[model samples]
Target: MADLHRQNEHGSRNRTRFPTQPTPSAPAPELRGHGLRLRPWDAECDTDVETWLRGNSDPEFRRWNTPVKLVDGMEDARESLRLRAEWDAEGKCVSYCVTDAATGAPLGHIGVNDIDHFIRTARVGYWVLPEARGHGVATRALRLAARWAFTNLGTHRLELGHALGHDASCRIAERCGFLYEGTLRGAMFDAGRHDAFRDVHLHARLATDPEPGEGEGKGE
Candidate 1:
């Protein structure tokens, strides 16, 4: 049989056009502060299927926030993992699983997306599991993530937006030191309201602003 590989002009075997494997990356660093720990997605151990499925399926969550579609089984979880990994690899977004510091159980999820390095800005979003709400989990996690974004990733401005009716989310943004900017009319899609579009309240925090006390790190 003829050789399957072709020789180039230099008389060396030419590599295949398509790679058989994905390029490896350095492991993402884990960020910890306050009462929470923020870790990169790890499907094997960190896949909180029940929490994810329930949180995303809530009609209130779907209406007030950009929600993940309902998930029914393992296949959906795997797809979610694949998409998250793609986002992390592309540097387009950095997502974290927020976990309790002492117990190591997942409390929720948070991320900074829409990264614009040229403008040194990004959009932040988060969701707390139903059981984890009312304990300030989102606020602490946001502060830790925001500090990392500003100090480590060179992000100068972080933006957060919530549906106008989400008073809890607005409070979390405020607790994390993000100032209310303005409202955008018909800027969001709310699924539970039978309305395709709804107004959103905008908030932002800048690197030059004072950091939230909850996330302040002790000198090491």
Candidate 2:
């Protein structure tokens, strides 16, 4: 297990505070899987990241990403990087940029937000570049993050939420071994419509569950 308190030398950079959110910090355990690396969000990767997101932000990819307004330039990525740093510093959340191991290209982003350490739980979210979708990049990155969380952060369980109509995300949650907990009725608002939140299936895996191993049995 990697040390949660230890900061990587590469991640050391000044960060600005979000008005209501804590600053982000380095992720624990420095996870890697499926030809991808998940590391703490850093400012140095700004150019690579902006390019990735710019090319990946399509209507197909943004349908479920209602919470994050799409940015039009590199400054937005810079601000997000700063917020990630603050979140890490305050331990309020942890975020990572998914990158290709061979080419070092930023593929997407994922994170555990709204974390409550005392409860040993957190919500997981992710987005893969449009071209990178259907390649298991999101699943690989998510499982790696969960492994780090449980093994290093003392998390007993992990939770995920997807909009009711997003069947793809639901499938990913199931494949990852998260049990469907239940739905929150009328709990979601998207695109100016108040939609009935699909029974937000709450799938969870214990720390002791068998590791599925990278890319093994992953759905296409």
lDDT of each: 0.74, 0.67
lDDT of 2: 0.67
Give the Å shift of residue 82 in candidate 1. Answer: 1.5
- For model 2 the TM-score comes to 0.75
By summed lDDT, the worst window of 10 consecutive residues in model 1 runs over 15-24
lDDT of 1 at 54: 60
Candidate 2 per-residue lDDT over residues 64-130, each given as its tens digit: 5544445556776676667667777788778787888888877778888777664466788888776
* Decoy 1 TM-score against native: 0.79
lDDT of 1 by residue, 19-89 (tens): 21112354446889887889887655435655565656655567676543445556666567667778777
Give the C-alpha miss distance for residue 206 in model 2, angstroms. Answer: 3.2
The weakest ten consecutive residues by lDDT in model 2 span 15-24
- Candidate 1, residue 16: lDDT: 30
Every model's Cα RMSD, please? 11.0, 9.5
Per-residue error (Å), model 1, residue 4: 51
